[model samples]
Target chain A: MDVWNILEYCAWALAVLFGGHMLIDLARVDSTYDNDLLTSSREGEIELTQELHKL
Target chain B: MTLSSAEPTVQAQASTQGGERLQLLRVLGPGHVWALGVGIVLVGEYMGWNFAVGKGGMIAGLVACWLAGLLYTCVAMIDSEVTSTVAAAGGQYAQAKHIVGPLMAFNVGLFLVMAYTMLEAANAITIGFLLDTVAGLQGHSGLHQPPFIVLTVVFLAWLNYRGVLATLTFNLVITAIAFLAIILLFVSVQLGASHVPLDFSAISTDPLPYGWLGILAALHFGLWYYLGIEGTCQAAEEVRSPARSLPYGTMAGIMTLLIAATLTWYVCSGLIPWEYLGQAGTPLFDAARVTGSTPLMVLLFIGTIFSTLASANGCINDASRAWFSMGRDRYLPSWFGAVHPKYRTPYRSIVFLVPIALIFALGAPLDQVVTFSILSGLLGYTFMTFNMVMFRRKWPLGTIKRGYVHPFHPFPAILLLLICAATYFAVFLGYGSQLIAMMCFYILASLWFHFWRYRFVRRGDQFTMPWPRPQGC
Candidate 1:
């Protein structure tokens, strides 16, 4: 294989690895809207307001 | 600043004031935010950055991408800091208002709206171009029909107004498909033996076709690869935990784009001659054609369509939110802030932006559309970095509970500002007419804000910075 071929192989490998890592991370996270953060509307607003003040 | 401690005080204050609340549904998480960020710029990796190669050849293009990547990395880090801290739906506009003042906020907000709307229009035009090319209508002058562009704008805007959850879900699915298509393209090229091997020796002689000047000229196309990642930051309020999700999602999105950009440049350039690849409108599709696989070309074309639609969808969501934020603050008509009662989305703002985008999409050339988007986007970026520096000065370390503090404080912000300014100048020199047109738009926006919008804002106590002021400031 030529140098360019080897480089292409490495690039593909890295791309797969990065894509895999991102997908795994996405899968592992709790992305549902059922948390206290989203369900309790009034409380969530207050919490966000407080967070803004802290900044 | 303990979460438990601060909650009671805020609740007590809220009880006393009893004000109308924001109607935006909080259904997004890191996944959605990441998807939005990736979706906004994913189309660039598929097509636009090849223009960099036309200007500076392959080597210069790669160098430009690397440099632009560094600048965007800094911008993303600072974005995480500000978005997490403020956690506002308005994104940079809110940050600007709190850090600088109302005028800067107005400019940033308008610039963001312009940037995203222009990007949406550009994507719509690209879809038209891609479809024409796929149908063997490449030489057909009548392919860019205005009705088709208007239809695309209307469809995406309707999708955006449906609901936040539905819009984000659609974005996530299309973004995933686009990424997969890119991987498939890379694999197809690697496995196929139809193309000539990349000539590294040619880099020394042929890559610098326009000498050093070409590298500078290529900066804006290089930037196209990562331009809209900050749009993800606009989802801060909708994100489940802005403090956590904003930083992680946006930074992760940037990393993904960096990898995608590098792979797209390397694999595609390796598959075809850089000179020819640079001038092609649909470089990835052409690269697939080089593999001599008709099926691969079809697959890549579908991917192109999905990527463009995903970008337009994400831009519609982002631009509407920005307009809603301005309207809610009374910067524009209060009509823009009205949420759909059933869907709990900013239907008015979404609908308002559609015709504006359609008009631009129908009237402007594709290259001009993209340039306008980039110019406005760079202006917003410069202001955002400026806001970051001011934010750091206003709230020193330990003054606030920062979810993700960028390590260098003001340095990253300063570096980003310089990079944005330099790229803006480069783009102005390279594309003077578009920049001049953008300047005229900016001047008109400023006049409207100062003369009309400012008066409306002054007439009410409704406009207030969401963040607490620094002591004695």
Candidate 2:
């Protein structure tokens, strides 16, 4: 319950959390490989960026 | 000059999206966008005055939040129109480049990256700060250490590289957690408190607190919390009906933020005394503890973690895309344009942002980084307001279909322009040191890119409409 012990525990816990999330992201990269969003929200920005490239 | 009457050419251009695939799900609507805004506002409003100001502070803060939200609404409405027209991934930088020119656009991109970088750094430090409080780790500034902070930065960077859907899904889940935290805190306070002192009239105030100056200063701090409204524009192409969706989503987000923020502020403030909440290092955590519910405290801690992670992810996703968009135009190094061979996302740009963010998170003071974030966000908004005015005069109404025409014609637009001008000047007076230095640094960097790297290229007429025109001058 002391401050020092508490700090040590959190530092370790966050490090683990950060590491786990990175691995999960890397694993999921393969599925999102297409040149679009995983889920669409709006088409304007995506479409415009595409149009600019064509120009 | 008007565009060529050839509609076919424009269609052809729309089909090819900068040599990238058009793969995504059109799942989000105005409702979803509103939820995201609610999520951001709820979290943002919780901070700032909660710990520092207290009950009287909360009463004053809610009024302050609403006034600031109104200013944000004006800025976002203009942004929604621009975003609807473009259907592009990057937000401010893309808008600036199309309207202002490459040189100015480059400045927007540089400042945007720095601004979001500050956001990322703030989230990390805030998370660290939160953890220290919950775990009773008072002196732990582990985030200040470069190696530890770099790990956090790299983690989010990789997540961004994974692409947009993963980020959005994460956003949804984290939002749930954030809301749950609020619910738990509210319940704990009511059930556990033998004496409940409730103030129903807390949110509504006459003439508003601090008057115009109070509102202005609140807007300044308000800018800090509601800063990322435009980030949604980065995902415009992914949304189904951006013309309808952009404005609707933005409005929804703002309303949700308002409601969530009001509830969180009032309930949490009632649970604990203002003096304690204001000065307490981890005010939310302290509030949970005071409710005498260990389970609720644990849930809040987990929820805060989720909130921080989601925020960092959202910030990085938008910031890196700005870099990628600029690179695609060959404004910055082409390396930024490199898409992951597999992920098909702006992997390189996303990766590059991590180190820069880490440098700031690990190296700078927390308050200094936060001030830089506000400066960058305001500077970008100032450019956006100007762009809205110029877009109206330069382009014919018939040419661009999706943009929101300023109601009451140019008068309202001009009023907004003046407001932006005054606010930008006031920001200089308020956070003058951090604001000036960060703006100067980016301005110089932009000039270096323009004169040195892109000197030989003939500058295109930036104000020209995207549609083609006749050659006879």
Candidate 3:
């Protein structure tokens, strides 16, 4: 109805989009990745081997 | 230095190189570390620290600043040393895990999660309130706060979910802008560029309006000046060189906050009366308005927005890292431990915490939320003193290769403990009931962990760092 209302609607649209994407991604990863690997004490040590980009 | 000796650290290294198991990207450097630490804290300089002036007076605020500054100096020194060695995502929680035991680490993890999450909620609500204030000034009333609040959380969560480097780089830019605004305001006032008359006489004449007891009360608010600076250590795992980057960035972060906090106090104390300043919502923005300079007013307005956004963003980063670390160790569901295949971010932890932050931002009482966050931080700092003492006794000097060895260890540990005890009294003086309530909550959580969650934790495997067994062991 008004500019403030329009802004509020736009925010709602963005929140739903972002929040929804996160949830769907969560489900996809849970389905795809091995549970043992996910819960392991180890993580990928790619940076330990070589120099990465600086600041 | 030998990655081969660290079973899990080495396994982690091998898996990422050989396999497709996603992990957090390691692209950050010292600048990102400084940005993460300072971005979470500079928001306090914008508004919260002036509450000390309200508690006692201008002089009491100054005293609290120095005393808290001393406390955090000890924190920065000890944290840099421990974090460099731990070199993990969880920061203090990792230290708690290695130096103490499972129970302490679990509680420390909860402390990190609760502290950062509540602060995130506080920041989101502040953004809402700040925009609402502006709208009211513009003759628009009844502006809804939830849309803005939710937008802030979700947008920042999205930024965090995408990548760590971009999120922190964004934090660095905005945090620098906010810090510069404080410097500009301070220099302009000091140079008499602002014709607004300021009285320095009240600072001396009525320095202690409420006497010595007021100084004790002010210590609690004094924490606002340098709160969360040690959070730089949370980026330890992501940084290129933990030894070099962690210490350098964290020390630089504390130095920056000390300068920013003092300038903020000096500017506002001289510009506004202590009576009103203690209660001002956006004190720096208020100070700019008092100058009758529109350009200055607009700059401060932008600074407030940037600081609030940066704080919320940093909170998301720290909280998710702590949560993801816990999940990996089976402290929570391993489900939350998954790194996104594409983004290399801890997507689940970041996403899950968003709703929790939204709830508090939307419905919780402001004072209760802030008090809980502050108490959690105090408990974490108290844990740190013991951590440092135990770290030295268990490992001793020269036993481990620390990135930055903190000199005069027993002194810093002792000083930190004493300051923590005094600050607890300050909390009790005003927030006695809330303090008790928070203790009960932590106790209940600890009991739950001991009885139920300990079963899931990999006791020996949690010690993933490659170090010689402790001297006492």
Query: Better model by DockQ, 2 or 3?
Result: 3
lDDT of 3 by residue, B1-473 (tens): 34422333455546655763545666788999999999999999887888888898888999999999999999999998888778888889888988999899999999999999999998998998998898788777888889889989999999999888899999999999999999999888877767688777887788799999889899998998888887887887677778789999999999999999888888898888889999999999999988888888999999999999999999999999999989888889888887765566778899889989988999898777888888899999999998998999998877767777899978999999999999999999989999998899999999999999899877788886766687777
lDDT of 2 at B301: 71
User: What is the DockQ (computed on Cα atoms) for candidate 1?
Assistant: 0.05
lDDT of 2 by residue, B67-148 (tens): 5566677776777777766656566776787777677788888777777778888777776566545444445343233334
Top lDDT: which candidate number?
A: 3
CAPRI classification of candidate 2: incorrect
Could you arrange the candidates by lDDT from highest to lowest?
A: 3, 1, 2
TM-score of each: 0.84, 0.77, 0.94
Q: Give candidate 2 misplaced runs (Cα > 4 Å).
A: A1-55, B1-42, B49-60, B137-148, B183-196, B199-215, B403-430, B456-473
lDDT of 1: 0.76
| Model 2 backbone overlap count | 27
Of the true contacts between chains A and B, what fraction does model 1 have?
0.08
- Tens-digit lDDT track of model 1 for B12-87: 3453356444346566789999899999999998878999888888888899899899999998998888777767
- The alpha-carbon deviation from the true structure for residue B295 of candidate 2, after best TM-score superposition, in angstroms, is 3.9
DockQ of predictions, in order shown: 0.05, 0.13, 0.32
